[model samples]
Target: MQEARYTLDDLLTLMQVLRDPQQGCPWDVAQHWDSIVPHTIEEAHEVADAIERRAFDELPGELGDLLFQIVYYAQFGREEGRFDFHDIVHVLTAKMITRHPHVFPDGHLGSRRQGVAAVDVDTSAVGQRWEARKVNERDSRAATSHLDDIPLALPALSRASKLSSRASRAGFDWPDHRGALDKIREELAELEVEIEAGHQENMNAELGDLLFAVVNLARHLEVDPEQALRGTGQRFERRFRHVEDAVRESGHPIEHTDLDTLECHWQEAKRIERGQ
Candidate 1:
Protein backbone atom coordinates (compact mmCIF):
# COMPACT_ATOMS: atom_id res chain seq x y z
CA MET A 1 0.00 0.00 0.00
CA GLN A 2 1.27 3.48 -0.89
CA GLU A 3 1.51 5.97 1.91
CA ALA A 4 -0.24 9.33 1.60
CA ARG A 5 2.24 12.12 0.94
CA TYR A 6 1.41 15.43 2.58
CA THR A 7 2.55 18.90 1.58
CA LEU A 8 3.40 21.63 4.11
CA ASP A 9 -0.07 23.09 3.60
CA ASP A 10 -1.64 19.67 4.16
CA LEU A 11 0.18 19.28 7.47
CA LEU A 12 -1.04 22.69 8.54
CA THR A 13 -4.62 21.72 7.73
CA LEU A 14 -4.23 18.50 9.68
CA MET A 15 -3.07 20.53 12.70
CA GLN A 16 -6.23 22.68 12.47
CA VAL A 17 -8.43 19.56 12.43
CA LEU A 18 -6.50 18.04 15.34
CA ARG A 19 -7.22 21.18 17.37
CA ASP A 20 -10.91 21.49 16.47
CA PRO A 21 -13.59 21.23 19.16
CA GLN A 22 -15.99 18.21 19.35
CA GLN A 23 -13.97 16.19 16.80
CA GLY A 24 -10.29 16.82 17.56
CA CYS A 25 -7.70 14.41 18.97
CA PRO A 26 -8.36 14.45 22.72
CA TRP A 27 -4.68 14.94 23.66
CA ASP A 28 -4.11 17.78 21.22
CA VAL A 29 -7.46 19.33 22.13
CA ALA A 30 -6.62 19.26 25.84
CA GLN A 31 -3.35 21.20 25.56
CA HIS A 32 -3.24 24.86 26.63
CA TRP A 33 -0.78 27.74 26.20
CA ASP A 34 1.25 26.70 29.27
CA SER A 35 1.26 22.98 28.45
CA ILE A 36 2.57 23.43 24.89
CA VAL A 37 5.17 26.08 25.74
CA PRO A 38 7.86 23.49 26.53
CA HIS A 39 7.29 21.72 23.19
CA THR A 40 7.82 24.99 21.31
CA ILE A 41 11.13 25.60 23.11
CA GLU A 42 12.19 21.97 22.55
CA GLU A 43 11.39 22.16 18.84
CA ALA A 44 13.40 25.39 18.54
CA HIS A 45 16.42 23.66 20.12
CA GLU A 46 15.96 20.72 17.73
CA VAL A 47 15.98 23.14 14.80
CA ALA A 48 19.24 24.64 16.10
CA ASP A 49 20.75 21.16 16.43
CA ALA A 50 19.79 20.34 12.86
CA ILE A 51 21.48 23.52 11.63
CA GLU A 52 24.67 22.91 13.65
CA ARG A 53 24.97 19.26 12.58
CA ARG A 54 24.26 20.13 8.92
CA ALA A 55 21.51 17.52 9.05
CA PHE A 56 19.97 18.50 5.72
CA ASP A 57 17.61 15.51 5.68
CA GLU A 58 16.60 16.18 9.28
CA LEU A 59 16.01 19.90 8.75
CA PRO A 60 12.59 19.49 7.08
CA GLY A 61 11.35 17.13 9.81
CA GLU A 62 12.66 19.41 12.58
CA LEU A 63 11.14 22.51 10.95
CA GLY A 64 7.84 20.66 10.55
CA ASP A 65 7.90 19.97 14.27
CA LEU A 66 8.39 23.72 14.88
CA LEU A 67 5.63 24.63 12.42
CA PHE A 68 3.23 22.23 14.14
CA GLN A 69 3.98 23.95 17.44
CA ILE A 70 3.06 27.32 15.89
CA VAL A 71 -0.09 25.84 14.33
CA TYR A 72 -1.19 24.36 17.64
CA TYR A 73 -1.23 27.79 19.29
CA ALA A 74 -2.84 29.39 16.24
CA GLN A 75 -5.61 26.78 16.06
CA PHE A 76 -6.41 27.14 19.74
CA GLY A 77 -6.46 30.92 19.38
CA ARG A 78 -8.82 30.58 16.39
CA GLU A 79 -11.24 28.36 18.35
CA GLU A 80 -11.36 30.97 21.11
CA GLY A 81 -12.01 33.71 18.45
CA ARG A 82 -8.85 35.46 19.60
CA PHE A 83 -6.77 35.19 16.41
CA ASP A 84 -6.12 32.77 13.57
CA PHE A 85 -3.07 31.20 11.92
CA HIS A 86 -3.07 34.00 9.31
CA ASP A 87 -2.67 36.62 12.04
CA ILE A 88 0.32 34.75 13.38
CA VAL A 89 2.00 34.77 9.98
CA HIS A 90 0.95 38.34 9.21
CA VAL A 91 2.31 39.84 12.46
CA LEU A 92 5.72 38.17 12.06
CA THR A 93 5.91 39.08 8.38
CA ALA A 94 5.21 42.73 9.22
CA LYS A 95 7.73 42.70 12.06
CA MET A 96 10.48 41.22 9.86
CA ILE A 97 9.95 43.92 7.26
CA THR A 98 9.66 46.74 9.79
CA ARG A 99 12.82 45.93 11.77
CA HIS A 100 14.98 45.64 8.64
CA PRO A 101 14.80 49.33 7.67
CA HIS A 102 17.77 49.09 5.33
CA VAL A 103 15.58 46.91 3.15
CA PHE A 104 12.13 48.38 3.84
CA PRO A 105 12.65 52.08 4.62
CA ASP A 106 11.56 54.78 2.20
CA GLY A 107 14.02 55.38 -0.67
CA HIS A 108 15.33 51.82 -0.15
CA LEU A 109 16.39 50.41 -3.55
CA GLY A 110 16.26 46.69 -2.72
CA SER A 111 13.40 44.26 -3.39
CA ARG A 112 11.50 42.83 -0.39
CA ARG A 113 12.00 39.38 -1.92
CA GLN A 114 15.74 39.81 -1.73
CA GLY A 115 16.79 38.33 1.61
CA VAL A 116 18.44 40.17 4.52
CA ALA A 117 21.57 42.02 3.43
CA ALA A 118 24.70 42.10 5.58
CA VAL A 119 25.88 45.36 7.17
CA ASP A 120 29.42 45.54 8.49
CA VAL A 121 29.55 47.33 11.85
CA ASP A 122 32.67 47.83 13.94
CA THR A 123 32.65 44.96 16.46
CA SER A 124 33.81 47.38 19.16
CA ALA A 125 30.94 49.79 18.46
CA VAL A 126 28.13 47.22 18.09
CA GLY A 127 25.41 48.94 20.12
CA GLN A 128 25.24 52.39 18.52
CA ARG A 129 23.03 52.24 15.41
CA TRP A 130 21.60 48.69 15.67
CA GLU A 131 20.78 48.99 19.35
CA ALA A 132 19.25 52.47 19.09
CA ARG A 133 16.77 51.10 16.57
CA LYS A 134 15.90 48.23 18.92
CA VAL A 135 15.38 50.68 21.79
CA ASN A 136 12.86 52.64 19.70
CA GLU A 137 10.92 49.47 18.82
CA ARG A 138 10.83 48.28 22.43
CA ASP A 139 9.81 51.67 23.74
CA SER A 140 6.86 51.59 21.34
CA ARG A 141 5.69 48.23 22.77
CA ALA A 142 6.80 48.04 26.41
CA ALA A 143 4.95 49.63 29.33
CA THR A 144 8.18 50.83 30.88
CA SER A 145 10.54 53.15 28.96
CA HIS A 146 13.71 51.21 29.86
CA LEU A 147 15.45 49.51 26.93
CA ASP A 148 16.63 46.36 28.74
CA ASP A 149 13.55 44.23 28.21
CA ILE A 150 15.05 40.77 28.56
CA PRO A 151 12.26 38.30 29.33
CA LEU A 152 12.21 36.87 32.86
CA ALA A 153 11.74 33.31 31.57
CA LEU A 154 14.97 33.22 29.61
CA PRO A 155 17.76 31.05 31.18
CA ALA A 156 19.55 33.03 33.89
CA LEU A 157 22.85 33.31 32.06
CA SER A 158 21.23 34.26 28.76
CA ARG A 159 18.91 36.76 30.42
CA ALA A 160 21.78 38.36 32.35
CA SER A 161 23.93 38.66 29.24
CA LYS A 162 21.12 40.28 27.29
CA LEU A 163 20.27 42.68 30.10
CA SER A 164 23.89 43.67 30.64
CA SER A 165 24.52 44.17 26.91
CA ARG A 166 21.44 46.36 26.59
CA ALA A 167 22.37 48.36 29.69
CA SER A 168 25.89 48.79 28.34
CA ARG A 169 24.42 50.20 25.13
CA ALA A 170 22.48 52.70 27.25
CA GLY A 171 25.76 53.91 28.90
CA PHE A 172 25.38 52.03 32.18
CA ASP A 173 28.49 49.96 31.51
CA TRP A 174 32.03 49.23 32.66
CA PRO A 175 34.50 51.50 30.92
CA ASP A 176 36.00 48.67 28.90
CA HIS A 177 36.05 44.88 28.47
CA ARG A 178 38.94 44.81 30.98
CA GLY A 179 36.65 46.40 33.56
CA ALA A 180 34.06 43.71 32.83
CA LEU A 181 36.72 41.03 33.42
CA ASP A 182 37.68 42.71 36.69
CA LYS A 183 34.03 42.54 37.77
CA ILE A 184 34.02 38.81 36.98
CA ARG A 185 37.14 38.32 39.15
CA GLU A 186 35.56 40.31 41.98
CA GLU A 187 32.35 38.28 41.77
CA LEU A 188 34.40 35.09 41.92
CA ALA A 189 36.28 36.32 45.01
CA GLU A 190 32.99 37.19 46.72
CA LEU A 191 31.70 33.69 45.97
CA GLU A 192 34.83 32.15 47.47
CA VAL A 193 34.49 34.27 50.63
CA GLU A 194 30.87 33.19 50.99
CA ILE A 195 31.85 29.57 50.56
CA GLU A 196 34.55 29.83 53.23
CA ALA A 197 32.07 31.43 55.65
CA GLY A 198 29.60 28.55 55.07
CA HIS A 199 26.93 30.96 53.94
CA GLN A 200 25.04 28.84 51.41
CA GLU A 201 22.59 31.58 50.35
CA ASN A 202 25.29 34.15 49.86
CA MET A 203 27.42 31.61 48.03
CA ASN A 204 24.54 30.81 45.67
CA ALA A 205 23.84 34.48 45.04
CA GLU A 206 27.48 35.29 44.44
CA LEU A 207 27.83 32.28 42.13
CA GLY A 208 24.91 33.61 40.08
CA ASP A 209 26.57 37.01 39.95
CA LEU A 210 29.80 35.37 38.78
CA LEU A 211 28.01 33.50 36.01
CA PHE A 212 26.23 36.68 35.00
CA ALA A 213 29.57 38.42 34.80
CA VAL A 214 30.87 35.60 32.58
CA VAL A 215 27.93 36.21 30.24
CA ASN A 216 28.85 39.91 30.11
CA LEU A 217 32.41 38.88 29.28
CA ALA A 218 31.14 36.70 26.43
CA ARG A 219 29.20 39.66 25.03
CA HIS A 220 32.33 41.80 25.32
CA LEU A 221 34.28 39.15 23.37
CA GLU A 222 31.51 38.97 20.71
CA VAL A 223 30.64 35.34 21.59
CA ASP A 224 27.22 33.83 22.21
CA PRO A 225 27.05 32.53 25.81
CA GLU A 226 24.21 30.07 25.03
CA GLN A 227 26.01 28.52 22.07
CA ALA A 228 29.29 28.30 24.00
CA LEU A 229 27.60 26.49 26.92
CA ARG A 230 25.72 24.20 24.50
CA GLY A 231 28.99 23.17 22.84
CA THR A 232 30.54 22.41 26.25
CA GLY A 233 27.48 20.33 27.18
CA GLN A 234 27.73 18.34 23.94
CA ARG A 235 31.45 17.72 24.48
CA PHE A 236 30.84 16.52 28.05
CA GLU A 237 28.04 14.19 26.92
CA ARG A 238 30.29 12.67 24.26
CA ARG A 239 33.22 12.12 26.65
CA PHE A 240 31.02 10.82 29.50
CA ARG A 241 29.23 8.32 27.22
CA HIS A 242 32.60 7.01 26.04
CA VAL A 243 33.66 6.42 29.66
CA GLU A 244 30.33 4.73 30.44
CA ASP A 245 30.64 2.34 27.50
CA ALA A 246 34.25 1.46 28.33
CA VAL A 247 33.42 0.74 32.00
CA ARG A 248 30.41 -1.38 31.03
CA GLU A 249 32.62 -3.38 28.67
CA SER A 250 34.98 -4.11 31.58
CA GLY A 251 32.09 -5.72 33.58
CA HIS A 252 31.83 -2.93 36.16
CA PRO A 253 28.79 -0.88 37.07
CA ILE A 254 29.38 2.89 37.03
CA GLU A 255 27.99 3.36 40.57
CA HIS A 256 30.34 0.73 41.98
CA THR A 257 33.47 2.44 40.69
CA ASP A 258 35.45 4.87 42.83
CA LEU A 259 36.29 8.40 41.64
CA ASP A 260 39.91 7.46 40.95
CA THR A 261 38.85 4.51 38.75
CA LEU A 262 36.27 6.63 36.98
CA GLU A 263 38.84 9.35 36.39
CA CYS A 264 41.23 6.81 34.83
CA HIS A 265 38.49 5.57 32.51
CA TRP A 266 37.48 9.17 31.66
CA GLN A 267 41.07 10.03 30.79
CA GLU A 268 41.30 6.93 28.64
CA ALA A 269 38.12 7.91 26.79
CA LYS A 270 39.55 11.39 26.15
CA ARG A 271 42.85 9.90 24.92
CA ILE A 272 41.03 7.44 22.67
CA GLU A 273 38.78 10.14 21.23
CA ARG A 274 41.70 12.54 20.75
CA GLY A 275 43.95 9.79 19.23
CA GLN A 276 46.54 10.67 21.85
Candidate 2:
Protein backbone atom coordinates (compact mmCIF):
# COMPACT_ATOMS: atom_id res chain seq x y z
CA MET A 1 0.00 0.00 0.00
CA GLN A 2 1.20 3.50 -0.80
CA GLU A 3 0.70 6.60 1.31
CA ALA A 4 -1.77 9.20 0.09
CA ARG A 5 -0.33 12.35 -1.44
CA TYR A 6 -2.33 15.57 -1.35
CA THR A 7 -2.11 18.84 -3.24
CA LEU A 8 -3.23 22.38 -2.36
CA ASP A 9 -6.68 21.58 -3.71
CA ASP A 10 -6.82 18.71 -1.26
CA LEU A 11 -6.03 21.10 1.57
CA LEU A 12 -8.83 23.40 0.42
CA THR A 13 -11.21 20.47 0.25
CA LEU A 14 -10.22 19.43 3.76
CA MET A 15 -10.94 22.92 5.02
CA GLN A 16 -14.33 22.86 3.33
CA VAL A 17 -15.18 19.51 4.87
CA LEU A 18 -14.16 20.74 8.28
CA ARG A 19 -16.52 23.66 7.90
CA ASP A 20 -19.41 21.61 6.48
CA PRO A 21 -22.74 22.25 8.23
CA GLN A 22 -23.73 18.61 8.75
CA GLN A 23 -20.44 16.74 9.05
CA GLY A 24 -18.05 19.46 10.12
CA CYS A 25 -15.87 19.53 13.21
CA PRO A 26 -17.85 21.64 15.65
CA TRP A 27 -14.89 23.75 16.71
CA ASP A 28 -13.83 24.50 13.15
CA VAL A 29 -17.39 25.20 11.98
CA ALA A 30 -18.11 27.47 14.92
CA GLN A 31 -15.07 29.75 14.39
CA HIS A 32 -15.75 33.21 12.94
CA TRP A 33 -13.31 35.85 11.71
CA ASP A 34 -13.07 37.60 15.07
CA SER A 35 -13.00 34.39 17.08
CA ILE A 36 -9.91 33.10 15.25
CA VAL A 37 -7.99 36.36 15.35
CA PRO A 38 -5.99 35.45 18.46
CA HIS A 39 -5.09 32.04 17.05
CA THR A 40 -3.94 33.68 13.81
CA ILE A 41 -1.73 36.07 15.75
CA GLU A 42 -0.29 33.27 17.89
CA GLU A 43 0.46 31.14 14.83
CA ALA A 44 2.27 34.07 13.21
CA HIS A 45 4.35 34.60 16.33
CA GLU A 46 5.18 30.88 16.44
CA VAL A 47 6.46 31.09 12.87
CA ALA A 48 8.66 34.03 13.81
CA ASP A 49 9.87 32.26 16.95
CA ALA A 50 10.81 29.15 14.99
CA ILE A 51 12.81 31.21 12.50
CA GLU A 52 14.50 33.20 15.28
CA ARG A 53 15.54 30.00 17.05
CA ARG A 54 16.98 28.62 13.76
CA ALA A 55 14.66 25.63 14.03
CA PHE A 56 14.46 24.96 10.30
CA ASP A 57 13.01 21.50 10.85
CA GLU A 58 10.08 22.97 12.79
CA LEU A 59 9.49 25.72 10.23
CA PRO A 60 7.20 23.69 7.97
CA GLY A 61 4.77 22.92 10.83
CA GLU A 62 4.80 26.54 12.00
CA LEU A 63 4.26 27.76 8.45
CA GLY A 64 1.43 25.30 8.00
CA ASP A 65 -0.26 26.61 11.15
CA LEU A 66 0.04 30.16 9.80
CA LEU A 67 -1.27 29.06 6.42
CA PHE A 68 -4.20 27.32 8.06
CA GLN A 69 -5.10 30.62 9.68
CA ILE A 70 -5.38 32.15 6.20
CA VAL A 71 -7.40 29.16 5.07
CA TYR A 72 -9.73 29.55 8.04
CA TYR A 73 -10.41 33.17 7.10
CA ALA A 74 -10.84 32.23 3.47
CA GLN A 75 -13.37 29.59 4.41
CA PHE A 76 -15.35 32.05 6.51
CA GLY A 77 -15.27 34.60 3.71
CA ARG A 78 -16.59 32.03 1.21
CA GLU A 79 -19.54 31.29 3.49
CA GLU A 80 -20.35 35.00 3.51
CA GLY A 81 -20.02 35.18 -0.32
CA ARG A 82 -17.13 37.65 0.01
CA PHE A 83 -14.00 35.83 -1.25
CA ASP A 84 -12.18 32.55 -1.12
CA PHE A 85 -8.67 31.13 -0.95
CA HIS A 86 -8.16 31.56 -4.68
CA ASP A 87 -8.98 35.22 -4.40
CA ILE A 88 -6.38 35.60 -1.68
CA VAL A 89 -3.81 33.70 -3.75
CA HIS A 90 -4.58 35.71 -6.86
CA VAL A 91 -4.23 39.05 -5.09
CA LEU A 92 -0.89 38.07 -3.52
CA THR A 93 0.44 36.68 -6.81
CA ALA A 94 -0.61 39.73 -8.76
CA LYS A 95 0.80 42.08 -6.15
CA MET A 96 4.18 40.31 -6.21
CA ILE A 97 4.38 40.38 -9.98
CA THR A 98 3.30 44.01 -10.08
CA ARG A 99 5.73 45.08 -7.35
CA HIS A 100 8.87 43.43 -8.77
CA PRO A 101 9.50 45.47 -11.91
CA HIS A 102 13.05 44.16 -12.22
CA VAL A 103 11.80 40.57 -12.52
CA PHE A 104 8.37 40.76 -14.18
CA PRO A 105 7.79 42.02 -17.69
CA ASP A 106 4.67 44.04 -16.66
CA GLY A 107 6.55 45.83 -13.86
CA HIS A 108 7.57 49.50 -14.10
CA LEU A 109 11.29 48.65 -14.23
CA GLY A 110 10.76 46.77 -17.52
CA SER A 111 11.70 43.11 -18.04
CA ARG A 112 14.61 41.62 -16.08
CA ARG A 113 16.55 40.72 -19.22
CA GLN A 114 16.30 44.23 -20.64
CA GLY A 115 16.93 46.10 -17.36
CA VAL A 116 19.85 43.93 -16.16
CA ALA A 117 21.50 43.95 -19.57
CA ALA A 118 21.25 47.72 -19.85
CA VAL A 119 22.65 48.75 -16.42
CA ASP A 120 22.87 47.88 -12.76
CA VAL A 121 19.72 48.34 -10.66
CA ASP A 122 20.50 49.03 -7.04
CA THR A 123 18.38 47.23 -4.43
CA SER A 124 17.76 50.53 -2.65
CA ALA A 125 16.20 51.93 -5.84
CA VAL A 126 14.06 48.81 -6.17
CA GLY A 127 12.87 49.19 -2.57
CA GLN A 128 12.02 52.84 -3.12
CA ARG A 129 10.06 51.95 -6.25
CA TRP A 130 8.18 49.27 -4.37
CA GLU A 131 7.20 51.74 -1.65
CA ALA A 132 6.17 54.26 -4.31
CA ARG A 133 3.93 51.65 -5.94
CA LYS A 134 2.35 50.84 -2.57
CA VAL A 135 1.72 54.54 -2.01
CA ASN A 136 0.01 54.70 -5.36
CA GLU A 137 -2.16 51.74 -4.42
CA ARG A 138 -3.14 53.50 -1.21
CA ASP A 139 -3.92 56.65 -3.17
CA SER A 140 -6.22 54.63 -5.44
CA ARG A 141 -8.15 53.71 -2.28
CA ALA A 142 -8.52 57.46 -1.44
CA ALA A 143 -6.20 57.20 1.56
CA THR A 144 -5.86 60.67 3.11
CA SER A 145 -2.68 59.96 5.05
CA HIS A 146 0.61 58.10 4.53
CA LEU A 147 -0.09 56.07 7.70
CA ASP A 148 -3.62 55.14 6.73
CA ASP A 149 -2.94 51.53 5.68
CA ILE A 150 -0.69 50.48 8.57
CA PRO A 151 -2.49 47.80 10.57
CA LEU A 152 -3.45 48.76 14.13
CA ALA A 153 -2.88 45.13 15.26
CA LEU A 154 0.86 45.22 14.62
CA PRO A 155 3.18 44.92 17.67
CA ALA A 156 3.82 48.31 19.28
CA LEU A 157 7.51 48.53 18.35
CA SER A 158 6.89 47.38 14.77
CA ARG A 159 3.94 49.77 14.37
CA ALA A 160 5.97 52.67 15.76
CA SER A 161 8.85 51.90 13.41
CA LYS A 162 6.45 51.71 10.43
CA LEU A 163 4.68 54.95 11.42
CA SER A 164 8.03 56.71 11.69
CA SER A 165 9.13 55.28 8.34
CA ARG A 166 5.95 56.46 6.65
CA ALA A 167 6.34 59.91 8.21
CA SER A 168 9.97 60.03 7.10
CA ARG A 169 8.90 59.21 3.58
CA ALA A 170 6.52 62.16 3.86
CA GLY A 171 9.45 64.43 4.92
CA PHE A 172 8.37 64.67 8.57
CA ASP A 173 11.30 62.84 10.20
CA TRP A 174 14.69 63.55 11.75
CA PRO A 175 17.55 64.13 9.33
CA ASP A 176 19.67 61.28 10.69
CA HIS A 177 20.33 58.77 13.49
CA ARG A 178 22.02 61.50 15.55
CA GLY A 179 18.78 63.47 15.62
CA ALA A 180 16.79 60.39 16.58
CA LEU A 181 19.24 59.58 19.39
CA ASP A 182 19.00 63.14 20.67
CA LYS A 183 15.21 62.88 20.66
CA ILE A 184 15.48 59.71 22.78
CA ARG A 185 17.63 61.53 25.33
CA GLU A 186 15.13 64.41 25.46
CA GLU A 187 12.25 61.98 25.93
CA LEU A 188 14.10 60.18 28.73
CA ALA A 189 14.66 63.53 30.52
CA GLU A 190 10.94 64.26 30.31
CA LEU A 191 10.19 60.79 31.69
CA GLU A 192 12.51 61.49 34.62
CA VAL A 193 10.74 64.76 35.32
CA GLU A 194 7.36 63.03 35.28
CA ILE A 195 8.65 60.39 37.67
CA GLU A 196 9.98 63.02 40.06
CA ALA A 197 6.63 64.81 40.01
CA GLY A 198 4.94 61.49 41.02
CA HIS A 199 2.28 61.90 38.39
CA GLN A 200 1.38 58.37 37.20
CA GLU A 201 -0.56 59.52 34.16
CA ASN A 202 2.19 61.90 33.04
CA MET A 203 4.83 59.23 33.70
CA ASN A 204 2.93 56.74 31.56
CA ALA A 205 2.74 59.21 28.69
CA GLU A 206 6.40 60.16 29.06
CA LEU A 207 7.42 56.48 29.14
CA GLY A 208 5.53 55.91 25.92
CA ASP A 209 7.27 58.91 24.39
CA LEU A 210 10.65 57.49 25.43
CA LEU A 211 9.84 54.11 23.88
CA PHE A 212 8.57 55.75 20.67
CA ALA A 213 11.80 57.75 20.46
CA VAL A 214 13.84 54.56 20.92
CA VAL A 215 11.81 52.89 18.18
CA ASN A 216 12.52 55.86 15.91
CA LEU A 217 16.24 55.55 16.68
CA ALA A 218 16.05 51.87 15.74
CA ARG A 219 14.36 52.79 12.46
CA HIS A 220 17.04 55.38 11.78
CA LEU A 221 19.69 52.72 12.46
CA GLU A 222 17.88 50.33 10.06
CA VAL A 223 17.26 47.79 12.84
CA ASP A 224 14.01 45.92 13.42
CA PRO A 225 13.10 47.01 16.95
CA GLU A 226 10.71 44.09 17.56
CA GLN A 227 13.31 41.50 16.65
CA ALA A 228 15.98 43.34 18.66
CA LEU A 229 13.78 43.44 21.75
CA ARG A 230 12.71 39.81 21.33
CA GLY A 231 16.35 38.76 21.18
CA THR A 232 17.07 40.75 24.35
CA GLY A 233 14.15 39.00 26.10
CA GLN A 234 15.41 35.56 25.07
CA ARG A 235 18.91 36.35 26.36
CA PHE A 236 17.51 37.61 29.63
CA GLU A 237 15.46 34.43 30.09
CA ARG A 238 18.47 32.22 29.40
CA ARG A 239 20.68 34.14 31.86
CA PHE A 240 17.97 34.21 34.52
CA ARG A 241 17.47 30.47 34.22
CA HIS A 242 21.21 29.99 34.70
CA VAL A 243 21.08 32.14 37.84
CA GLU A 244 18.17 30.06 39.14
CA ASP A 245 20.04 26.79 38.49
CA ALA A 246 23.09 28.10 40.37
CA VAL A 247 20.95 29.06 43.33
CA ARG A 248 19.27 25.65 43.33
CA GLU A 249 22.65 23.90 43.24
CA SER A 250 23.83 25.98 46.21
CA GLY A 251 20.81 24.77 48.25
CA HIS A 252 19.49 28.35 48.60
CA PRO A 253 15.82 29.13 47.88
CA ILE A 254 15.50 31.86 45.28
CA GLU A 255 13.26 33.84 47.66
CA HIS A 256 16.05 33.83 50.30
CA THR A 257 18.74 34.97 47.79
CA ASP A 258 20.15 38.46 48.41
CA LEU A 259 20.62 41.02 45.62
CA ASP A 260 24.42 40.69 45.82
CA THR A 261 24.18 36.88 45.62
CA LEU A 262 21.92 37.09 42.60
CA GLU A 263 24.23 39.64 41.00
CA CYS A 264 27.19 37.28 41.51
CA HIS A 265 25.30 34.45 39.85
CA TRP A 266 24.20 36.73 37.01
CA GLN A 267 27.79 37.74 36.31
CA GLU A 268 28.87 34.07 36.41
CA ALA A 269 26.07 33.24 33.98
CA LYS A 270 27.25 35.98 31.62
CA ARG A 271 30.83 34.73 31.86
CA ILE A 272 29.69 31.17 31.09
CA GLU A 273 27.58 32.40 28.16
CA ARG A 274 30.60 34.32 26.79
CA GLY A 275 32.84 31.21 27.28
CA GLN A 276 35.18 33.36 29.41
**Model number with the top TM-score:** 2
| Error in Å for residue 246 of model 1 | 4.2
Q: CA lDDT of each candidate?
A: 0.80, 0.91
| Steric collisions counted per model | 0, 0
* lDDT (tens digit, per residue) of candidate 2 on 1-276: 999988889999999999998999998988899999999999999999999999999999999999999999999889999999999988898888898867776554344545265257688888998999999999999999999989988999999999999999999987889999999899999999999999999999999999999999999888999989998999899999999999999999999999999999999989998999
List the candidate 2 regions with Cα displacement exceeding 4 Å: 107-120
RMSD, one per candidate, in order: 3.8, 2.3
Cα lDDT over the full model 1: 0.80
Candidate 1 per-residue lDDT, tens place, 135-155, comes to: 778777764845346777676
Error of 1 at 165 (Å): 1.2
Top lDDT model:
2
